[model samples]
Target chain A: MEKAIRKFWPIFVLPTLGAFAIGFLWPFVWGVYLSFCRFTTVQNVSFVGLQNYANIWIDNTFTHAFFFTAAFTVVSVALINVFAFALALLLTRKLRGTNLFRTVFFMPNLIGGIVLGYIWKTLLDGVLALLDRPLLALDATAGFWGLIILMCWQQIGYMMVIYIAGLQNVPIDLIEAARVDGATDFQTLVRIKIPMVMSNITICLFLTLTNSFKLFDQNLSLTNGLPGKDSQMLALNIYDTFYARSGPQWKGIGQAKAVIFFIVVAAIALIQLRATRSKEVQQ
Target chain B: MKAKKVVSLLTASVLALSMLAGCSAQPAADSADGAAESAPAAQEESVAQESEVAQEEAPAADGAAGQVYYLNFKPEQDEDWQNVAALYTEQTGVPVTVVTAASGQYETQLMSEMAKSEAPTLFQVNGPVGLANWRDYCYDLSGTELYSHLTNESFCLKDGEEVPAIAYVIETYGIIYNKALLEKAGYTADDITSFDTLKAVADDIQARKDELGVKGAFTSAGMDASSDWRFKTHLANLPIYYEYKEDGIGSTEAIKGTYLDNYKQIYDLYITDSTCDPSELATKTANDATAEFVNGEAVFYQNGTWEYANIEALGDENLGMLPIYIGAEGEENQGLCTGSENYWCVNKNASEEDIQATLDFLTWMITSDEGRAAMSQEMGFVTPFDTFTDEFAASNPLLQDADAYIAAGKTPVDWCFSTMPSENWKNMVGSALTAYAAGTGSWDDVVTAFVDNWATEYQLSAAAAG
Candidate 1:
């Protein structure tokens, strides 16, 4: 069987390899090459060495969007993970109607991002109007807080499900032994349970971090970088630069920004995976 | 030995099967390559099928030669356009497809669609500035039959001798006022012709709000995407129009902030005398503003002829158009801002057959009686064709009012705003205005966005093209 498998490896791998080359590798290579070129349509490209990257230095909006997106990711990642974990711990207990609570909590994750943004916009506006201030009046600060709340609402449940799965796998025998040895709830939670579920924490944190960084639809439908694009995120900034700005040069600049965004996200995610992996217990 | 033989035979069959599967997949990959490289071939196949039907039914039909795919811009008139396309197909035995991009997304959609192999045969540009970006894609319509159908040749956009786009519809927009509400407030149409009178009447109505049992004098000026164009594009036009007149120039390479004070005066009036507190205008939408006019809660609404259908419940007698009195010198001579951004440009890259078909279709839509009825009745369009009658204008109360202004010798403001550097520039100005209204930003920021941003974007576009 081993000999047969080894002999037929090329035949088995050829289709998938061919598909991956066509679907991803070729386009990715082409996109990188085009990032250095200036063209409106793909057919009419002209190479202009590093000019697009140079323009990004003068683009104040790109800088603003970078910092805005960074701050948002940090806040949302913290809130989403903490709340989701707490909910997971609570729901894992032998409480009545845990299934129903879990189902209800998880339902919001099913809604589309654009729909969620618009819904929260209406709700936030109504609340803000009651205080005699419109949502857009609060400027970038209000937009920041609104997006944070929205991200928490949409993501907590999804992370909670993952956390719950992690919690269920935490050896019951060890938890019992800790309790029998006169361990308090806090000790058991801190030393026994959390250490055991570090892998889940790693996954949830990675997911929330990456998702927050790449957000677009929600940012668009909610504030749309109002007050002169003050609340614009990096992804939205890249999008606006690509499609919104009129000049042909803007598209190439937008491509450079996107390449930068990709590099930042990939590096951060990789570093996080390594850091989290080291902290994770064997169990 | 016997077991080894059986195992070897099974492995041989399995290897043969795997080899067969690999061989089968090559064409599938190759075909994808073929599809990407030859979209026109695939499209031609479909066109051939369509032409087969045309030949059986109407062999002599003019539309039989080619197919038309129009990427329409207006979302409001999308259904009407689809109906028109269907009607044309029914009449000519030709296939006509109309795809309308969502509002504010036309440029983005056009860019992507133009990159596709089966690009739109017909598309639109806003004006000269829009034509500048898309000029390379536009076919010359200089000697086409459709060019002769244009009532005014000046409305057509040209790159020197090349007539790239033709304005199909002429639209007029101004401050639409409710006559009954104005009369009830003890003001006549003549009384509110200037900025002072308009302000005075608005203040009076605001002061006596309880007595009148209404909201503020106008609707909330929303700064959302749906409504921002009202201020950024249309309202901003007033200043540009006046400045152009003062400078004695039809167009400018770069605009100086000459009439910005008048621009501020009108903007202040919109916020100060409205139902919404100026602070809340950013969250308000265009629909909320229209509701104020539709429900008779506001006597005035700053919009255009296109909004007539939305507010037709007020009846034609109560509805009237007022010039946007932005406190300009000699303001009485100003009429409604009368121009168009809806110019039809046939795609230069489309097949010659398709271009000819598009030209025929456009000429027929303007010149033929049935086509004119569809344009005016279904779409409520004010066509720029000699074939159109006053009856179409009469149906639209705002257009009728605009015609009255025109007959009285008020010079209609040419849509100089269409020459705005970019949509992003307009958006920046809109945001600055919203922020200024909200007390979040100073007006100097708006001036910078308007002046500096315009120059920067203009240079960038020029640099990009060069």
Candidate 2:
């Protein structure tokens, strides 16, 4: 049976491999090549070497977007994980209407990012109007905070589900033993449950980190980098460069920015995964 | 066990075959069937139904004449365009497919569609700057019937002897005022000829707003994406136009912004004597401003003739348009901002037959009785085609007001916003203007964005073009 499966493995692997090459690998490689060329479309390209790369910093908005996105990601990741973990812990315990609460909390994740952004914009703007304060588009600080709140609201539920799964997977015997050994709730959570779920922590951290970094639709639909593009993030910045600015060279510069974006995200994700994987317990 | 093995193997093969079929279906449908069949399948249900009608008619006709796929830019007139196309196809037995891009997404849509194998034979360029990006793809219309039917030489976008694009509509924008509301505020259109009078009247109206039973003199100066163009591009055009007139130039690589002070004054008037708080302008949408005007809550709404449909609830006799006064040198003699941004360009990359079909369709749109009616009546367009006689003139009162201005010999302000560099430049200026209006930033920031960003963006585009 093992021999037959091995012989037919090519049939299983080749289909997926072909799809990956066509759908992702081929386009990715072509995109990287196009980053070095000046063109309106992929078919019409003229090589211009490092000119696109050099022009990336000509506008300071790109740099501003990088710092803004980094700050947003840091704040959102920390808040999302912490709140999601707390919710997961609470829901995991024997509580009334636990399933109901879980469903209610997790429902926000089902809404699309654009829809969520626009809905929150309306809601937040109404609240701001009542307070007689500057609206999200007018105030960069408010825009930033609004986005953070929005990201947390949308992401906490998803992360909570993951954390709940991890908490459940923790052997009941281990938790019981910790309690039997005169451990308090906090002590058991700190020493046993947390260490036991390190793998899930790694996954959650990776997911939240990448998601926050790569956010586009929400940023676009919400403030749209208003208040003089003060609240613009990296993905939105790259998109504006590509679509908002017209010229053959702008497309190449946008592509170059995207390549740089890819590298930064890849490096950060790799480092995070490595650091978390090292801390994960054997069992 | 043997039966279970056979079932598992069969399921695996079926899954792989289905995957391959799914992968191969798209390109095959796209290339072989052409856009008439494929575009509808990919589009919404309404478009799909329209194409099904086209497909039904197509089989009975000869295949000598190529099909027309028009990538329409205006979402507001999409239904009208689709109706016109269907009418043309029913008459001529030619398949005409019209796909309208979502508002604010035309450029991106055009870019992607232009790259497709079954690209749009008929497309549009906003103006000179738009023409620059699409110059290579534009088919020359020098000797074509469409070009011959153009009423004015200036209406054609020329590249030497080649007419690359033709302006289909000539639109006018200014301050659209409700006559009754203006009268209630103790003013008339004649009372506000220049910026000074406009300001005085607006201020008095704001003061007497409660007595007059109106919200404010002007609707809220909305700064959202849907509405910001009114100020950033249209209002901004006044400064650029005045500067160009003073410099005696059509276009420039750098703008001096000599009339920015005037621009500031008009903008100040808009925010101060408005329906809502200036700080809240950032979140106000175009729809909000339109509602205020239509509901008789505001006396003045700054928009264009295209907004006729939206503001038609106000009786035609009650509605009037006044030139946007920005205190220019010949301010009293300044007419409404009049020019064309909607220029039709045939895609040069398309087949010769397709190009001819597109040109024929365009000519038919302007010349034929049903076509002229659709353009003027249904679409509310004041077309530049000679075939559209005075009898076929649009009944839109705002357009008649524009004609009145022209008859009075007021020098119409050409659309200089087209030459105001890139959309990014406009965005930066818009953001600055919004920030300034909201009191979060200074007027100096607006100046820097308008003057400095203009030069930089112009240079960037020039560098790329060179």
Candidate 3:
């Protein structure tokens, strides 16, 4: 078996490796290279080192979108994980209709981003309309909170399912042992239940964090970075920079923005995983 | 594990296909800037003359082999075009393809269609930016028969040896209001001769919004940040165009908007007085704005001739299109914003059969009787062709008022904003302008933000493309 595996391993791996290099590795390298160039199409790209990066720092919209996305991710991750964990804990109990409830909670995650955005926009705008107001109004406070509310509503149900798997995997013996030792339910949860779910917390946090940062379709359809482009998120910002403008030259600069975005998101995700993993008990 | 591997491989292959597909742009759609007024007129005599000339040129009785394809920009304008396309196919036995892109998805749609093996032979090349983008692919028409047919030099963009594009139709826009409403409110179309007079009527309507069964003078108060072109690009043109008209030619071609203060005057008017509150406008959807206008809650609508179909469709004969002449002196004669939204350019890479077929179709659309009539009837717009005289929206009272302005020698503003290709400028300016409109941003901040950001973004666009 070992001899046969060794002979076929490379044969099986070569096509995938080739496909990856062509599909991802090439584009990744090209994206980094193009960030320094000034051209419309890839063929016309001329080397202009560091100029694109310089423009990004000075771009007010970039700064705004960055802050907007960071705040959204931080707020969304905390809320989504907490709410999801709570739901998971409740459903994991010997309760009626738990499977049905789990399925319903997970269903929202299946909907397309654009469709969800439009749905939320219509629902929110309709509610606001009843009060003799419209969406994208002069109320700066309203647009900001409206977006946060939208982010939370769309994400909570998705995070709940990830948390359910983690809760289900928690060893029943650990809880029984705590109960035998005269530990209260709250104490058992803190010492045993919560500690065991650390891995799930890490995953849920990462998904929420990354998803929030990379959100484009929802931001586009829900608000379209509208009212004055004040609500423009990072992904939307990169898109507008590339296509919304007249020339193909910004494509390079937009490419640079994308590379930087990847780095930031990757670093944040790594940091979060490391922080969460450290608390996870091996048992 | 096996399924995981399969799915990953499939995902990788699909991603690769998409990347390659994106690189290969569609052929004629990008190049063919379909003239907003490509429809000529229905003339029996002209058709007979055209057919006689065509018969003399080609005695090939079988029109079966000949085919023409046109990439249309507007889906709404397809109603009349269907009849025209069908007529052309029947008369010439040439198949005509009219693929209309949704309202704003023109560029991407154009490129996608162009990359196809069976690319569109005819498409639009509207502005200088459009010319810059698709100039390489354009079929040169310096010596073509179509070159002799063009009467207006102002419409065509020629690169010494080649004519890349021509603005097929020039349109005009302004304040479209109910003429019947105007008469009912103790005013006449003649009374609204200037900006102040028009505003006075609007303000009066606002004062009696409840009494007159109207909610506001202009629907949602005209501050649609999404459709900022109506203000940022078009209405903002009034001051710039006035300055250009005063000199009878543009000063240096490229301007930093010297009369932004005048722009603010009209802009402030749009916000302070409306159906929706200024603060609520940021979240205000477009449908809500137009709905208010159509419901007779707003006496005025700020749009162009393209909206005539929508207006007529609303079944309200009381709602009419008025003049957009804000406050410029001698602006009474100022017509609606008139120019081509897109221009048709034939693809250089297309086959001889395809190219000839496209040219023949274009000529037929411009000169054929049935083709012309169908176009006007559908677009709710008149074609810019010299021989075309059908009033597409003759029943529209608003067009009636806008035409009077045109008759007074107010040459409509040729689309100067098309040069500024940044939705960045519009959106950024829109954000800053909103604060300005709402008395949030100071004049210094507004101008500084506008010019500084404009220059920086302009530089960024140039650097990225350079």
Candidate 4:
């Protein structure tokens, strides 16, 4: 059986493995290489290492976007997970309208990022218009908070759906046992139910963190790194660098920025996973 | 797992096969039947698309398939252009196709379109780098019938031996303000000549914004995504373009931003005293800004002349235009910020019959009275044609301002902002300046960014292009 598995392993894996190499692995390797080269299109490229990397550090907007994206990810992850977990707990009860509430809450995630941005931009601008200015008024503080509000509103529902699934599978026998041991309902939840759903929390945290880091369309359509570059996220920063200049060479710098972005995102994901994994109670 | 993998593999193969088959199986005009039906005709068509000197020397279009295509850059200009196309198609009986690139994605569309064998016969290769990129695709038109009518030879793309494109039309922009709002605030259009006078007027209008039933003299200075170019490119050039006005600045040139501090004076006024708070402007988009301006709630709308159709179509004729004087010393007779963001270029790779059709279409569009009039009405500005007239131009007070600026011996500070690889550079500048607009970054940082980073971007772009 082991011999059969070994022989068929490559047979089973080859297509997907080939696809991965072509679609992701090859491109990822090329991206790292391109970060060192300068060219308009990939067909014609000239190697010029260090310059793209050096320019990225000198770019103040890139620094600001990095910090901004980091802060946004941290705040958004915690809020989304906590709020979603709470919603999941509430909705997974023996109560009426639970399904309706879940469906309604998750609807925002169904809308696309660009659409969400435009809708929120209009809504926020309308609200602020009453205060004598619209959204993006004065500067990007409103834009920053507006984006925060948008991210939360758009994400919470999606996370809640995941959390609800986790809640449903939380081994009801354990909670019952805790209750029989003279534990209060709240105590039972804290000790038993919470520990059982650690995996969900980890998943929710990771998704929110990564999404927050890679945010571009919403950022682009909402603030567009507006009030100049104050609200620019990392993705938009890379996009702006690649297309907004005149000479035929910015692709290298843009590629380098993208590579750095990948590294930062991966590192943050690892750290988040580690942190979340430490708290995970193995079922 | 093995069965599932096999099933997925089958599905993936089917999909890949279908996609490749779809691309390759096109029964296009350049199919195998090409050599059989009309070898002599194909040769004749190629001559029409070649240079006119070559056209003069080549065979006639007796057996040629006369076809034309204009890959239009402006979706807004389609209504007028389509009618013009129909008229020309009727006039010449050559099959003409007019395709409009989806708004803001012209470059992507053009590249893919150019790769096809039956590529656009005529399309807008808009600027210097664009022309440079599309060098092979365009047939040289140094001495075409269309080139003969061009009085302003400056807009032409000149190589050592040839000029690739001749300007089809010209448009101008500065600032579009609410004239009634200004009048109600106790000021007139004539009162806005110099920077001092303009500032005085804006200050007064802003002070009594509520009295004028507006939020402020200028709309929300939204430095946001949907509309960063209004500032990053157009208004940002006020200083640089103003400095370059002493010596005529070309479309492909980037001048050092020497008068940047002077440029900041207007930008400072725009952000500081506006109705919207600075922090909020970062998130704000141009749609919000335009909505306010269109609703007649904002006195000043920062936009180009092309916006007149949208503004007027929305039933807001009260909207007027002004130049970006920005309280500069001795700036009374300043013209409206004027230049072409979209310049039309016909494809050179097309067949001779196609080139002739495009040239015929262009000639008729400019020379024909009805065609020129419709274009003017749609555009709401002066066409480069010396004798063209339209109601939209006559009715629009903004055009009057543009005319005054031009007639006063004041050269229109042609917006040189398109000199950059606009989308990429605009975003960078927009991002860098957002901090300043948000009151977080200092002016020095912004200036340093524009000066030093512009050079870096230039070098980066040069290396990439090379």
Best by lDDT: 2
lDDT of each: 0.82, 0.88, 0.68, 0.70
lDDT of each residue in A1-283, candidate 1, tens digit only: 9986765565566556666776679878877777898877666677987888888756578899999999999999999999999999999999999999999889999998888888999888788778766464347888899999999999999999999999999998999999899999999999988999999999998999899999988898888887678899999999888777665677788888888888999999999999998989996
**Which portions of model 3 show Cα errors greater than 4 Å?**
A1-60, A95-104, A122-144, A226-229, A270-283, B1-69, B79-83, B86-95, B114-119, B158-161, B222-226, B247-258, B313-320, B349-353, B389-401, B436-452
> Cα RMSD (Å) per model?
5.9, 3.5, 7.7, 8.8
- Looking at candidate 2 chain B, the ten consecutive residues that score lowest on lDDT are B28-37
lDDT by residue for model 1 (B303-407), tens: 998898899899988899898999999987888889998999999999988998888888888777777888888888887777776654437878888889999
Residue B380 lDDT, candidate 4, scale 0-100: 48
List the candidate 1 regions with Cα displacement exceeding 4 Å.
A1-26, A132-134, A180-182, B1-63, B389-394, B460-466
DockQ (Cα-based) per candidate? 0.38, 0.52, 0.34, 0.22
- What's the alpha carbon RMSD for model 2? 3.5
**DockQ-based ranking:** 2, 1, 3, 4
Q: What local lDDT score does residue B136 receive in model 2, on the 0 to 100 scale?
A: 87
Worst 10-residue lDDT window for candidate 4 chain B reads B27-36
Per-residue CA lDDT of model 3 for B186-227, tens digit only, reads 787678767787778778877877778776777664345456
Best by TM-score: 2
* Whole-structure CA lDDT of model 2: 0.88
Between candidates 1 and 4, the one scoring higher on lDDT is: 1
